[model samples]
Target: MAEYAEITYTVEDRIATITLNRPQARNGYTVRMSDELADAFGRADSDEEVRVVVFTGAGDHFCVGADLSQGGFDFDGEPDGPWQEPAGRCAKRIFLMNKPVIAALRGAAVGAGITITLSADYRLAATDARFGFVFTRRGIFPEGASAWFLPRLVGMGTALDWMISGRLFGAEEARAAGLVQRVYEPDELLGKAYELAREIAASTAPVSVAVTRQLLYRMSGLDSPLPVHELDSKLIAGLPAHADSVEGVVSFFEKRPPKFTLEVGKALPAYLPWLDS
Candidate 1:
C-alpha cells in the first residue's frame, strides 16, 4: 500500500512491472530512488497475484549510474544510526523475493544500473545497452554485493576485468561473459522480457519457482554437494503430496498448460531450512 514517487509498479496477467520513472534524469541513481525500489519490490513479493516481475526503466537510458548533478552523489547517512549502500537496498530485496525477476535494460546500464540487477533471475539487454562495473573509477567500492555475485555470474577472470578496470562494455560482450541472459533490439527488449515472464506465469507453479530460486542461490554456494543432496532429498520427498506437484504431473501427461494453484505467500514448505534466514 506504500506510495512510490521514484518508480512505478503495475501488474498485468500476474506479472508485476516495476519501472524506474525518472526519464528526465535518465533514471539517475539516488538514495530516494533506491528506497522506493526496495519498497516496490517488497510490495510485489508479498502480493500473491504477482507471479513474476519485469524490472525496467522508463527512458532512452535505463540508468546512468549515480546522480552527480550536485557535483557529487545524492546520498544520505546517519552517523548515529545504521545505514546500507544504495544499490544493495534494491539488490537484496529482489534476492529475497518469492517470485522470479527479469530485468530489461537498454542504453546505458552502467555502475549502479548494472549492479542493481545482479540478483535478478534473468537480465535481458537491448542491442545498444552498455554496462560497467565502474565503482573503482568512481572511487567507490562495490555497492550491491557485486564482488560476490559478479564472479559467480561470469568467471573470476572476467569479474576481475570488469570490476578492477571499471570500463564500459557492450551488450554482446556482456552476453558473451554471461553477465546478461540475452540481447535483443531496443524495440524488442520489453516484449522479450514479457514473453518470458508470461511463459513462466502460465506454466510454472509459484511455490515451486520460489523454492527453486531460493535453493539454487543459497545452496549453490555451499562447499559440498552432500548438504545440497540432503536438502534436495527432503524437498523431493514432499513433492508428491503438494497440490502443485500433483497438477504438474497431470498436466504433463495431458500435454496441456498447467493450472498450478499454489501461492508462495502460503504454500512454501515449513521445513525449508532458510525460512528464517
Candidate 2:
C-alpha cells in the first residue's frame, strides 16, 4: 500500500497490480517512475501474499515512451552508473522477480514502454493496443535491454524488423510476431489478466513456480543441455522431500485444489542454478 506519484500498487486475491498512473501524459516513462516500478517489483517478489503481478496503465494508454515534454535535453542526466538506464533498472527487476508478471497492455506502448514489458512472462494486450520500438524514430537507440530480450522473445528476425523499422503495429501483429500472447477487447483486458493470475495462484506451488521461472529464463542462455540436465537432477532430487511436492501429489490424488503453504520469501531452495558459480 505504498503511495506513489506516478503509479499505484495494490494487492488483491494474491495478485499484485502495479499501475502506471500518469494517464494524462499517456503514462510517460520518467526516472522517478522507473525507480518506483523497480521498488514495486521488489515488493511483490518479497511479499508472501503476492502470487503474481499484473502490470497495466491507469486510464487508456499503457505508456507512450519517455516523457519528452522537456524536449531534447530529456535524455541528459547524471549516470546512475556507467551503463545503467532508468528503463533497464525497472526491466531487470522484473526479470529477476520470483512471481509471474503479466502485462495487460492497452493503447499506446512505444519505445521504453514496450521494451520494459519484454521481460514479463506474459503480455495480454487489448485489441486496440499499438506497440512501437520508436527509439530509432526519436534519434536514439533502444534501452531497457531490449536488444537482448526482444530477440529472445520474438526471434532475431522479427525483433530486427520491429526495432529497425520503428513503425507502429497493432495487437494482432504483435501477437503474430510473438510479442503478445493474447488480445482482448479494451474492457476485457484486465479481467482476462486477473483470471490468468488467479488460475496460477490457485493451482501452483510458490517455490516450484519461482524455481521453474528462473530455470526457464536462465537456462535459455546456456550453451547446452548438459547444464539443464545437471540442474534438473539436483532440483528433482530435493523436491520430493518438500511439503509442496507432497501436497502437490496428494492433492492430485484427492482431486482437490492444493493449499500451498510454502512461501517464495522463505521456501526457495538455497542452491539455485543461476546462483551457482
Best by lDDT: 1
- Residue-level lDDT tens digits of model 2 in 1-277: 3678999999999999999999999999998898899999999998999999999998999999889888742543766668468789889999998899999999999988898898999999999999999878878899999999999988999998998999999999999988999999999999999999999999999899999888888897888999899888888998678999999999999999998898777777777856553
What would the TM-score be for candidate 2 when compared with the true structure? 0.96
Q: In order, how many clashes per candidate?
A: 0, 0
TM-score of 1: 0.97
Worst 10 residues of 1 by lDDT: 73-82
Residue pairs that clash (backbone atoms under 3 angstroms), model 1: none
- Full-model lDDT for every candidate: 0.92, 0.90
Off by over 4 Å in 1: 77-80
